[model samples]
Target: MPFYLEIIISVSLLTGGVFLLVGSYGLVRLPDIYMRLHSPTKASTLGITGVLIASMFFQSHLKGFLSIQELLITLFLFITAPVAANMIAKTALHHSNKPAEKTQNQALMDTIRDRESPPSNSIK
Candidate 1:
């Protein structure tokens, strides 16, 4: 209920809101799925983290105890967002999703996609 606490909460909420907006904008404006994946995974992760941190602070200040649930959620989100992004990217690659014309490292992508098959004699 203190003035300083309100300022802290407001600042955190603003930061989170800004990051979330940026991430959403990036998702809509990016040219390709691979590029789009970076926004929600990275920017939105930080965005939600900021909001959760604000929640933790406000809850702790109000209740005189830290809320473990928000902490756990934050931890879980941090762990899973990148992993989910990785899986989605791999799926996109498996489906042969093409990058934008101006995308860099075209040869690297092709090389990864066209790597030589392992020998038939190799372990199954």
Candidate 2:
């Protein structure tokens, strides 16, 4: 492998590692489920994306062709992370999960939950 390729891979891996570490730390240190969800869904998504990009680069360099597997993994990650986060947020709202004292827009969550719930008359 060329020196430039090595440097690229190293930088990508380091960036991924940093994001992963930040996500992990945030998950552990954040006060509530809503805030904690933000960390892994966003930061860890980017972190894994970075690692996948590095893998794609390395594999392409070695085999002289792009790696479809890495592309698929990245695509799925992009698709699923936010969807999963949204689902989790909805679940929390369904359970009336409380946000931390400092969390903003507390009423917005209640509004959303109300909007998503069918009217009582509809149940008849």
- Per-model TM-score on C-alpha atoms: 0.89, 0.88
Least lDDT summed over 10 consecutive residues: which range in candidate 1? Answer: 106-115
Residue 109 lDDT in candidate 2: 82
RMSD to true structure for each model, in Å: 2.4, 3.2
The clash count of every prediction, one per candidate, is: 0, 0
lDDT of each: 0.90, 0.91
Which pairs of residues clash in candidate 1, taking residues 3 or more apart in a chain or in different chains?
Answer: none
Q: How well is each residue in 1-124 modelled by candidate 2, as lDDT tens digits? A: 9999999999999999999999999999999999999898989988998899899999999899887799899899999999999899889988999899999989888788788556889886
Candidate 1 has what TM-score? 0.89
Best candidate, TM-score: 1
